[model samples]
Target: MTEVRGVVATGKGKPVEVTTIHVPDPGPGEAVVRVQACGVCHTDLHYREGGISDEYPFLLGHEVAGVVDAVGEGVQDVAAGDFVVLNWRAVCGSCRACRRGRPQYCFDTRNATQPMTLPDGTPLSPALGIGGFAEKTLVHAGQCTKVDPAARPAVVGLLGCGVMAGIGAAVNTGGAGPGDSVAVIGCGGVGNGSIAGAHLAGVRKIIAVDTDPAKLDWARRFGATHTVNATDHDTVQAVRELTDGNGADLVIDAVGVPQTYTQAFYARDLAGTVVLVGVPSPDMRLELPLLDVFARGGALKSSWYGDCLPERDFPMLTELHHQGRLPLEEFVTEEIPLDDVEGAFEKMQAGAVLRSVVAF
Candidate 1:
């Protein structure tokens, strides 16, 4: 086993701490990653708040870019020295989803069999199956999605989660295309990512909605053609006016609240697609008019991880970033040390940053 320092959350609704943890050597089909950069996502905060589960001493941080340090028996796809972006879902090929050629919805995903624990041997539940807030972490070999080494670690690593989900929501789920008008209800990393995706897909109009003016400003950098201040105006009405009173062709709810979801539902054109990429709270309930649901003549889908295949999408998007097609680096509002995670979370709550990446 290898001893490393990791950011761990010890209790529900408690602050996280950087403490010494023991990461075991790779077992069969597993690999050890020497983390270079990891993004502080909302999901990490969710885990700390016990929104994901009651699992304590949770190892937070998952959107990571790292170098493979070791591999165990039967690992062949990646080896030592490979720079990779970690993904939560590493499909088991024999699973029902994979057998049907839809590995994005894999019923069985894999992680390391060995546990990463505290120095006292207390087990730590790694967030999203990736304890990447540490100097080094063990994960399933397939979780390592290789990207171009030339790309910035913090930049591409954001694609490990939120950014990927947003982009995939627009490009993969919504299938936004040329001349299409798209409305993204949120201006966070995921919302801005959807704007970028729509732009890359040749979308002519991208409407960005948010209560924060700073986020609205940031949305423009990602190619949002219009901005909607939700606090000042009716989001649905503004979207309709911007799209010739017909509403947007595609509407993505990146903020998973009932209010925003309702806005997205009504802000789309007839036969338009509505993609929900945000993670909603368990207690939150939806009470849309069943008649409206039946009257909306389009598909309404929830995007799980943007329906993205890491192997296929990661490299392609990173390449686009390299070619100056995707402005992914803009997502990194600040680069911080692992110790500043709590501060980063504060910044996240205040809507002061798009993403605060921990650079080891």
Candidate 2:
């Protein structure tokens, strides 16, 4: 076992603390990662606030990149010293989705069988099966996707989650192509990533909608051709106006709220796709007119992890970043030590950053 200092959320609505945790040696099909960087994501905050489950003493922070430090017996795909990005979906090849050749929707993903625990032997629940807030973390070998070693850890690590979600939402789930018109609601990191992905896919018109002016400005930097402040105007109307009095070919709701989703539903052209990438609370409900659903004549899809296959997508995205085509560096708003996680969460809650990465 390895003794590592990690941030732990002891209970709901309480601040996390730096404590010593024991990361056991990798078991069969598992590997140990010496984390180089991990991004502060909203999911971590959700876990800390008990939005995920009742599991306490949660080890949070999932978006990560690192070097493989060790591998257990039967692990052949990756070895020690290999640079990798951690992924939550460690697909089980025999699952129904995998059998159908859609491993991205693998119903039975792999995770570490051995638990990382506190010094007192209390078991720690890893966030998204990857608690990377520590110096090191243990995960299934399948969860480690090899990437270009030259890429900056802080920037590339963002691909492990939100950034990937946004990009894949456009290119993978939405099937955006050349000359398509796209509109993204919620101009946060994920939304801007969708805009960037659309641009890369050769979309002709990209409209960004958000209540925050700062985020809208950031969206423009990410490839938004037009910006609409949702707080100042009707989002659906604005999107329609930007697309020549017709709605966009694709409308993405990155905010996940009922209102934003409704806006996205109404902001798409006939037969256009509506992709919901934002996560919603359990209490939130949607009540659209039943007749309208049939009348829309389009797909209403929900993107999980942007429908990405990490093994296929991660390397390509890293190459794009390296080629200066993806602008992955722009998503990183700040970098801080692991100790600053609490403060980073504060900034995230206040909408002050796109991403605050933790550098080890």
Candidate 3:
């Protein structure tokens, strides 16, 4: 075991604190990672607020990039020196989803068999099974996906979560490609990722929708051909006008609220795809007309982690960023120390930055 300083949320709505914790040496099928950088994702805040579970003293932070520090028995794919991105969905190859050859939807995922704990021996529940806001963390060996060592840890670490989700929502789930007209509702990290993905796929018309002009500008940097200020105009109408009155071929709702989702539903062309990459609150409900669901003549799909296979996607994305084809580095609005996570959360809530990454 080793001692490390990490951000921990001890109770619901409590501010996270940088405190001492114990990271066990990798057990069988596990690996210990020396974290280089980790992004401040909204999901981490959700965990801190007890929105995810009642697991208090939660080890917060998930989106991570690191180097393998140690590997346990029988691990061969990664070694002590490999640069990697830690992913939550460590697929179990024998699960039902994997048996059917769709490991992205693997029915069973794995985490380190042993626990990370506090000084008093209380176990910490890792946010999404990757407690990365620390100097080092232990995870399932499969969680470590080797990527280009040349890539910046602060930039590529985001692919561990939101960025990947946004990109996958468009490319993998939405099947965006050349000649497609895509509209993304929301201009945050995930939304900009969708815009970037659509750009990568060579979509002809990319429309960005948001209330914040600054975020819309960020969307343009990612790759939006047009912008719609939703606060001033109706979202569906603006998207339709931009797409030649036919609506976008693919509409992504990156904001998980009912209003944005409804806008996405009505803003797609006939037979167009609508992908929901945003996570909605558990208590929130949608009340769309049942007839509309049947008559839309398209698919309404919810994306979990952008339906990504981390092992396959992470390396590919890192290489793309390294090639300068994808401006992944632009996503990092600021770099912060691990101790400023509370301030980072405040900045996130105030819409002050796209991402505040913790660089170890």
Candidate 4:
């Protein structure tokens, strides 16, 4: 076992601390990653707030770009020194989803059998099965996807989660195309990512909706052809007006609240798709009319991790970023040290930054 410093949230609504932890050598199908960069995501905040679970002393941080430090027996796909992006869902090939050729929806994902723990031997529940806030972490070999080593870690690491989810929501789930008018609600990191995805897919009219002016400005950088200020206009009306009173071909709700979701439901063209990519609270409930659901004549989909197959999508997106087709680096607002996680969280909550990446 090797000692490393990592961010830990010990209790509900508590600030995370950088403390000592122990990482064991990789076992079968496991690998150790020396994390180079990890992006701070809202999910990490959810874990700290006990919104995810009551698992205390949680090891936080997931969206990771790292180098393989070691691999255990039977690991063949990746070896030591490979630069990789870590994904939470490591598809188990034998699972029903994989057997059906839809591995992105793998029901049984893989993680390391051995646990990283505190110096006193208390096992830490790594957030999203990654716990990449440490200098090094152990994970299933399948969780690490080899990407171009030339890509910046801080920029590429964001692809491990929110960015990938947003892009996947638009390109994969929504099937946005060159002729489609795509409207994305929220304009946060994930929202902007959807806009970027639409842009990458050659969408002609990409609309961004948000209450925050700063966020809307950020959305333009990712390629929003139109911006809707939710505070200033009725979201559905605005989107419809922009799309010739027919609504958009696709509407994505990156803000998972009922109001935004309702807007998304109403802001699409007949037979258009509505994709919900936001993470909503458990207590929040929706009461949409069943009649409206039937009348819409379109699909209402919830995107889980953007419906992405990491092995296939990661390399392709990384290549796009390398080719300057996808502006992946624009998502990073700041680079911080491991000790500034709390400050990073504060910045995120205030909507002051798209991403604050911890560079080790």
Reference-based TM-score of each model: 0.99, 0.99, 0.99, 0.99
Checking candidate 1 for backbone clashes, the offending pairs are none
What is the per-residue lDDT of model 3 for residues 45-64, given as tens digits with 9 covering 90 to 100? Answer: 99988889897889999999
Q: Is candidate 3 or candidate 4 better by lDDT?
A: 4
Cα lDDT over the full model 2: 0.95
Which tens-of-lDDT digit does each residue in 1-360 have in candidate 4? Answer: 889999999999988999999999999999999999999999999999999999888999999999999999999999999999999999999988899999989999999999999999999999999999999999999999999999999999999999999999999999999899999999888999999999999999999999999999999999999999999999999999999999999999999999999999999999999999999999999999999899879899999999999999999999999999999999999999999999999999999999999999
Q: How good is model 4 by TM-score?
A: 0.99
Candidate 1 local lDDT, 155-209, one digit each (tens): 9999999999999999999999998999999989999999999999999999999
* Model 1 lowest lDDT segment of ten: 10-19
Model number with the top lDDT: 4
Which regions of candidate 2 are displaced past 4 Å?
A: none
Models ranked on lDDT? 4, 2, 1, 3
- Judge candidate 3 at residue 234 and give its lDDT: 96
Each prediction's number of clashing residue pairs:
0, 0, 0, 0
